[model samples]
Target: MFTKILIANRGEIAVRVMRTARRMGIATVAVYSDADAHAMHVALADEAAHIGPAPAAESYLDGERIIAAAKATGAEAIHPGYGFLSENPDFAEAVEKAGLVFIGPSPRSIRALGLKDSAKQIMEKAGVPVVPGYHGDAQALVVLATKAREIGYPVLIKARAGGGGRGMRRVDHPDEFADALAAARREARTAFGDDRVIVEKLIEKPRHIEVQVFGDRHGNVVHLFERDCSAQRRHQKVIEEAPAPGMTAAMRMAMTQAAVKAAQAIGYHGAGTVEFIVDAAKGLKPDRFWFMEMNTRLQVEHPVTEMVTGIDLVEWQIRVAAGEALPLSQNEIGLSGHAVEARIYAEDPACDFLPATGTLHHLRFPQPIPGVTLRVETGVRQGDIISAHYDPMIAKLVVHARDRKAALSALASVLEETEIAGVAVNTAFLARLVQNSDFVAGKLNTRLIPRHQQALTSFPEPETRTMATAALAASGAKFAPDAPDPFDAISAYAHFHPITHRRAIRHGDRTRYYAITGLGDGRFAVRSEEENAETLVLPAEYGERIVPWPGHLTIFDGPDNHTFQLHDPLEQAGLAASGSESLRAPMPGLVKLVRVAPGDKVKKGQPLLVLEAMKMEHTVCAPHDGVIAETVAEGARVNDGTVLVRFAESNTPNAGRPARRNIEPSRL
Candidate 1:
């Protein structure tokens, strides 16, 4: 094996690689940007180097800087973790040119599958079934429109040069084709600098299944089964599982063979994933699957494959890079148990799923369970900042159990105990999803999330029994002295004068007041306008702060507890609007595109501006029907709450004029 290797990435993946390298006695070097100077991965590596500034282009994506760092540290190989520079073919070639091994597929193999259009053509030659689409070089409007018609209605327009759900659009009919294509090309140019696109037939209720294939320099390749990544939102995977719940032996065999064939076509070595989109409308079958794309590096959900098969993929990557064959063959790898992984991101699920950035004041996971292992791979520690310069993923919460049901239960329990403060996360939302009846029954597809959107976003209110228990616990020690008038404090003032105590509790939309009545023995009866009467019992062995944070309380009733997050009532009184009628920027980011001008008229819900932040696109919409008063030029960098546009009261002749501007929204 290589004595020392440079990790050309950051975040949890860097930490993950360092861990495996440590286990195999290989020294690891980490590269970081200014934003990640204090990151956990940097501190964990044997040596660290600063590449450039905070932005990805200046640092992580700077191939020359990464290569220099690797050589300066005397590293023999570089492992590009899943995101930045992982799939960049030029980076792979650059590392090899510098006499350093890229611990992944060869540059030639990466280039073979680098571009979508070219990869599709290659797959067609290999006899692997591919989605019927126009992958030609023609760019004329009329020609592309004809191709869309030939493919049939409901065609998908995807950028030929990029992935990650960017530069992708679906047109359900001919009338929507022109605008969709224009918008897609604009985003494609902004994101990848390539405006070329391919049209494909859109599959409804598609289930995404990807086969994990690994090879060695000896030309030996084996498949590690497949993972079902059907649970998605906005084209991003949220939950994943290995040994698909409803997979049959015949289908698995066929998919595995196809995956191996694709690997052999490229003389691939190391790890790569061949993704296929299956038509789930009629359930999974061998013939119903078609090639989607190939991820030319290690996947984010690789842990699920590791949990099922008793093989460490990272160790294999190292051994293969060291000129060794795969440790195990296809037959040697066995799916012993089921594993599921939930991606815990630093984003809010309720508010358009916008990415959030803040300091992590508190982060903790409960003790791992026996017989089922819970792995939390994270890069941030308490008090560390989550910046907007990188991906907002906090960690991948994975669990393994004997069966799918057991895995779901274990995951739900772990998510509940996982506490993250300062930055809003989707932990509670994920817990609700795993415990959902439909999810437990394995009625899964891409639409599962949208089908259960309401229930998933709406959290359950605290149970009465749980509230009562919390009240009892919050009351602290109970007194019953042997002396007379032991209840003096209660009796002296206890004329049943409606002893009411107000405690603020938040459930969903708003925080409301709760009335408490102490019933002896650390028990109390609680009532809210929305809750029924419930009893609470304090734990026999309790602390002043069970949940370990003040201003909030978690009451363990008979068998459950409810956590009530408290909000300061005075915060709203101090709130002030910074600007005039113009809509302000909600976060710091570059203005990717300006859709409106200074005097363009727009309707409600129209897209007015687009901001690129945290490596994702967010659209700012018009709040009401009005004429545009002002707008920032494209590519302008703006801070949070910087007004970019102002609307004038509409004065269309047909329709009466809008009300006066002096009248605010509430008054109007």
Candidate 2:
């Protein structure tokens, strides 16, 4: 094994790689940008180096800088974790040229599968069944349109060089083909710097099943079962499981063989994943699966595979890069139990899964149970900030059990017990998803979230108990020290009668007045507009407030953490009037395009600007029909809630004409 290796990435994946390297007695070096100077991964590494600024292009993607840092630190190998430069063939080649071992697939193997169109052709020739699509080299508008029609309606236009759901679109009709192609190309160019695309038939009710394959320098390869990544939102996997719920032995064997074949055909020599799109409109069968793409590096969902197969994929990657043979043959590898992984992201599910960035005032995961297997893979601390410059994934929660049912139940319990504050998160959404009847029954597909939209996306109002607790905390109620019993700690016997205090608290969209009365002897009576008065005992301490806000309180109510804003009398009076009209950014990001100008008329729901953040684009629309009073230009950096466009509240149209829709920005 190599003595020292540098991790050419950041975030949880970097920390994950370091953990294994450290355990194996290998020194690890971490490279960071300005934004990640104090990042968790940097603090965990044996040595750290600053590459460049926060922008990935200037730092993480700067191959030269990364190579120099590796050499300066005397790293014998470089492990490019799952994102940034991990899948870039040129970067892999560059690492080898610098006399450092790249701890992944060979550069030649990466180039073979870098482009989707070319990879499809290679798979077809290797006898690995591929999806029926047009993978030709023609890059003309008419040619793509013709191919989409030939593939039938509901065709998918995917960027030949894209992943992570970027630069891809689904068109259900011929009329929408042109628009979909144009949009796909634009996003593809922005994301991958490649405008080439391929058209494929869209499978209905598809389940994403990918097999983990490993290879060695001695031309030996083996497969590690499969993972079902069907639970998704916006074409991205949200939850994944190993030893697919309803997988049959026959189907598993066939898929595993096909994966190994694909890997060996490309001369693959490291960890890689062969993703297959399964047509589950019927049921999972060997013939119903087709090749989607091959990720030429370690996957984000590799933990689930590790739990089931009892194999250390990272350890194998290092050993193979050091010219070792395969650790085990295909016949010897077997799965023992079921494992499930939920990707906990700093995103608001109610806001269409918009990525959120903020300081993590308080963050905690549930402690492992005695008999249950629970693992948390994260690279953040309590005071760390989730920045817009990188992916907003907070952690991966993995649980293992004897069967799928036990694993799912344990996962749901773990998600509920997890606590996070200072930003909106999808913890509640994930808990609900795993407990859904259909999900529990293993009836999963790519459309699971969309099919259960109402139940999964609706944010519930705070319970009465939660509100009462918030009110008491905001009113400065504390436990009295000179009490005979613990229950009487909050009761001050100085007053013979109960003392009443009124305060206003805001929870979501509504603010209500609550009357809190101290009954002395550690008891208090609370009354709110929506609930009857009730007496309750006070605990010595409420939850802590991680943020520096004076009256803001983060209280744990059962499994969920509720953050309530204490109404400020002085600041509430200066709020904007109901008639005020302005379009503000919902999150901090760079203004990619502004479609309107001052005095331009716009209609309600008309897209006026596009903001790019967290590797995704969000459209800001006009909330009402009005004329633009002022607007910002494209290429401007803006913060969350920054007013990008001001509008006149008047109902009259500008220049006696309605605004044209041709210039409206596309919806994300």
Alpha-carbon TM-score of each model against the true structure:
0.84, 0.93
Of candidate 1, the 10-residue stretch with the lowest lDDT total is 659-668
What is the Cα-based lDDT of residue 622 in candidate 2?
A: 72
Per-residue lDDT of candidate 2, residues 1-668 (tens digit): 89999999999999999999999999999999999999999999999999999988899989999999999999999999988989888998999999999999988888889799989999999999998889899989899889888889888899898588887888999899887887788777877888899999999889999999999888898899999999987678899999898999889989999999999898889999999999988788889999999999999999999999999899999999999998899889888889999999997777667777888878889988656799999999988999888888999999989989889889999998888887778898999999999999989899899899678868667777677777887876766756575333545544465556788997754678887766664557778855655645454364543232445767755445577888876755544224444556656678887889988998888878777777776777776788899887799988766767877664422221112221222323
Highest TM-score scorer: 2
Error of 2 at 211 (Å): 0.5
Scored by lDDT, model 1 comes in at 0.78
lDDT (10s digit) by residue, model 1, range 1-668 = 79999999999999999999999999999999999898999999999999999988899989999999999999999999888888888899999999999999998988878678888888899998999899899987788899999999888898887566777877898998897887678777766668899898988888889999999999999999999998887567899999887998888988999999988888999999999989878777889999888888999999999999978999999899889999998888899889999998886666556677777766776679888988887887888888888888898999999999899999988887777766667887788889889788888887788789777877556655444445444433233423264331221224655234556655334555556554544333456545564334343344532452455554322112345656567743333222235666655778877888877878877887777776556777776788987788899998766666666653332121111111111000
Could you tell me how far off, in angstroms, the CA of residue 49 lies in candidate 1 after the best superposition? 0.2
Clashing residue pairs in candidate 2, if any? 480-489, 488-521, 491-521, 491-522
